[model samples]
Target chain A: MTPARRRTRSSAALRVLFAFAALIALTSVTAVVTHVVNTSAGLIAIRGGTESAATGDAAQVLASWTLLESMVYRSVIERDAVERFPDGTRIEFRSWLNPAFITGGYSADPTRTGVRGALIGSLWLIVIATIAAVPAGVGAAIYLQEFSAPHRLHRAMRESVHLLAGVPSVVFGLIGLVIFARLLGPLTSGAIFGVRATRVPTGRTIVSAGLTVALMTLPRIVIAAEQAIGAVAPRLRLAAFSVGATRWQVVRDHVLPQAGPEICAGAIFALTRAVGDAAAVIIVGASTVVLTDPSTPFAAFTALPVIAYQWAMRPDPSYRGLASAALLVLLLVVVVLNVAAGVVRLRARRTR
Target chain B: MTQDVGVANERVDTLSTEELTVTYDDIPVVSDVTVGFARGEVTALIGPAGSGKTSVLRALNRLHDLTPIARVHGSVRLHGKDIYDADVDAFEIRRRVGMVFETPTPFPMSIYDNVAWGARMHGRPSELDAVVEHGLRRAGLWDEVKDKLRQSALRLSAGQQQRLCIARTIAIDPDVILMDEVTAPLDPISTGKVEDLILTLRPDYAIVLATHNVQQAGRLSDRVAFFLVDESRAGRLVEWADTDSVFFAPRDARTEAYISGRAGSDMSARGRTG
Candidate 1:
């Protein structure tokens, strides 16, 4: 074929391919827009106390929101309690968006779901996990990056840490179960702190969940801290050394300052992962349905992810909305943590 | 060959090395390098790349301790005491014998803090502000950076950062200062500023400078040491003498060739004869 004719033929074929891709994109955009425009966040077939598609007399309390029966109507739903908007998104807020729901507990009815217990349990998990992981992870990173020579043993240790980051979170939960819950039950169950419990408190407490999160977060923090440490300019270390600073002194004053923001950013991301993790919390003894908030660290506990996990798996279709709402709350927390990570990263860039 | 450099025995030296040899992983890179730097004088170390000038500078302050595979033999003495003795600490020696690197390294901190950091590392000085001012003044950086002491040192230009490094070294109050091609990364104006700083510092401290610039060596040095690589590719000290003698009346044929541009090019041949 001549050059012009060959070019024209290829251009025609490219035009057809572009048109096909454009058509697919347009269709997807339309479908998404239609769903978003037609559906409401509060329109999930939910009733406060009535099983509505309203044509049938099949009303069940479990299909409605978590509110008192007096506050709800046959179909008007949480009419004057929790909150009622002009647009009829009444019971939606009572069960999933109100202060009561956020600060309350769970029941078998699914309509009475609240996440205060899980929220507090998650806070405990994160606090203990930070205590367990940050120091250990940062210290290990410093030693590996600054002190440890690239010999066989240190190399093996480094590689093992990287491999640990790849291990499933559920495995960390098992480790927590075997070690904290069974072997060190007294310590983990807070009996060592002289707190009295009804049954001496089983190993499945906030302590076990926190330690499990710690274990899973440790490898992530180490990996991130190592990368941050490695990115530090070698020139800075040399400057510190030439000024008569010792090895540890260099790491503390210069290296650590330079790498701090990046390390903190990494730690936050790792914490986010641990906070969103469910399987590990479950395996470590956090029940899917938590009814009470533990007053002390040694009491039985549950996390948001665990609650979401349990509710989403219910045989009844109405429980699915509650599960999704729980998940959205969990997602909000994750988003907040991710925003924290981004802030740290921006600060790091500015300092450098 | 080193014994023939008869001019080296003249001064009351502040720092001296005897039969010094350095090796990396058991392979000798620089061998039998014996030289001295007298107080109130600048000793310029001129040589080609990979001839071990930097290695020697690193050895002077025990900087080689940072590398496991690098080894040093023979004795380096300061004020008549061998610094390599086991009883002596590397930190103590480094504090006494400071170094300025080829590239400027300004810490990500305030200008005042950069100058004061070294002083604080040893022990917090009671009068840190006065000490910082003195060090910066001595480095010729006090006036330029006086108003911005609270700003980050990293914001300074390349030359200002280098002077800040000098100020940092001075803050520790060292007896000797090593400069490793410090002006190689500077513009002409900055080079002039640093060279002037070196001249002012000459009367108070023993300075050893490694440089590829011949004219700079002639202008800034009182003494010169020329290093060469033999067939074995191990660096050896060839000549050491007063700057004028080394530049105007080189005794060694190789030094003459290198100095006169007959050895290769000026950039390639940096040796000056005793």
Candidate 2:
């Protein structure tokens, strides 16, 4: 190749190399920061946070610390050795990510504490948000982009969607607190469903908080979904219309399916933003300490982010370590969801 | 100049317009234009850009209904019935009078579905495979896509995709087909293929095409309507006749200038105000 062409190709390769390096640096920074914070908190809890020096919990914690130290020796470690009696009945697992710490219910003791209540409640919130947000956001995006007559009101509404994105997440929480929690208290708190006691309901239910999160993420979903729909070729719509498909049919069969993957990717990102937010749910009346495994939409709930925020603020150093562990769980979930969205986008592009 | 508005006889015309006027945002784009398309014949609308060739073609298919600001002020008749009547469904009218666009438009679906989609919409699912094959065969795309019916239509070349769009349009068996510069964006070979396909379709359906390519019109059209911008900045049908008379005989000086490429240079500057 000529020198000029060779220079251009080399520059392109260098740009790609720089991009990969930047992405790797970003991931490494996050991992390193998390490790430092979690390890420092664990060390503080072990050295200064235990209430009584001679308590059985402290002794067990020390014993587990010794086993954890041995784990550093890769070639010499007991991968699975639970405490057991001579009769071989297993006593317990001695690890941070043990089943007790993942699935066990509410606990005051540090050894047996788990995220089950927060985990299940957060899942309920996701379900509620998906149900409430996807239809409204996707439908509005399609309608506004495809069917709305382009006049002053139409342009104003489209412009206001960007303004909505500019509003802080906490503002939506306040609105939800007023509208869904106070104004619609009877419906959200299940008082209308006969769960009300003699006292008035507070409306601190999963559905209310979920709706708050849904409201918080609505604009982002709309923006992303609109972009996806707009990216479709005009020729496709004309072709569908010329084939005698009705307006609804054109959107459903041609436009929607073509834009599905991008829309889903946008929804996933919007949900990721919602899933990490604690301020909104807390403002909408999530109770971190009294969290229960929500059985219905109207039940009181606490999400992982809210509980982590609460734990991280406790005076007890032990709670700090637990907070880091909770955050690690939340982090894992976010990573999995983001990866799924990437795969969806890649599959859609491949088909195109 | 000899006017051929009489060619669009009420009894003989398969598709005809009577003093059709199209306006957008209260501005007339095409004014008082009357034309007809006969069965098994090709009619070409030739004009400079922005002179409302596309707007007139869109009115024929009732596509202007999709645009909120566009209004039709004259009657469009199909099979002796006014299509713009209060009772006539625009969707049903469009089904009977299909359209193909300049850009290749294939649905984001399997090749089979693209051809079968219109038929499926009419609630006729019987013999879908046969219907798809017949449509593709007529559009000259069956042999290229037969083994890969499940492949996405977008994976085809631009020329092949254009043919796929043609197949998709014909699959529904509409009585009239409108083409707005269908081969303008294709390579020469693909353009040739599409032109040949249009000739094959001419004997089976009434075809109305809006084109800037003079040779394609000369090669394929039986009748030609020459449109120009009037002093009021609205597109008007200045000349209409058999291809030979409009091209060879003395008629309107404007049509002669356009046919001889004399008006091609600055006509577009006037067309913009239209």
TM per candidate comes to: 0.84, 0.82
Q: Where in model 2 is the C-alpha error above 4 Å?
A: A1-100, A191-202, B1-11, B230-233, B269-274
Q: What is the TM-score of chain A alone in each candidate?
A: 0.76, 0.79
lDDT of all predictions, in order shown?
0.82, 0.81
* Candidate 2 clash pair list: none
Q: Which residues of candidate 1, in runs, are more than 4 Å off?
A: A1-42, A46-100, B1-10, B264-274
Q: Top model by DockQ, which number?
A: 2
Tens digits of lDDT, candidate 2, A1-352: 9999999999999999999999999999998765744342222112222333245444233223322243453223222332222322322324454455668776776655788888887788777898898888998899898999888998898889889888887898899999999999989888888885232267878889999888877888899999999999877888899989999999999889988999999998988889888888989988766535677788777888988888889986566666776776777778888999999999989877
Each model's DockQ?
0.59, 0.64
lDDT of 1 by residue, B108-164 (tens): 899999989889876567889888999999999989999999999989999999999
> Each candidate's fnat, in order?
0.70, 0.80
Candidate 2, A270: how far from true, in Å?
A: 1.2
Interface RMSD of each: 1.2, 1.1
Q: At residue B233, give the lDDT of candidate 2.
A: 87
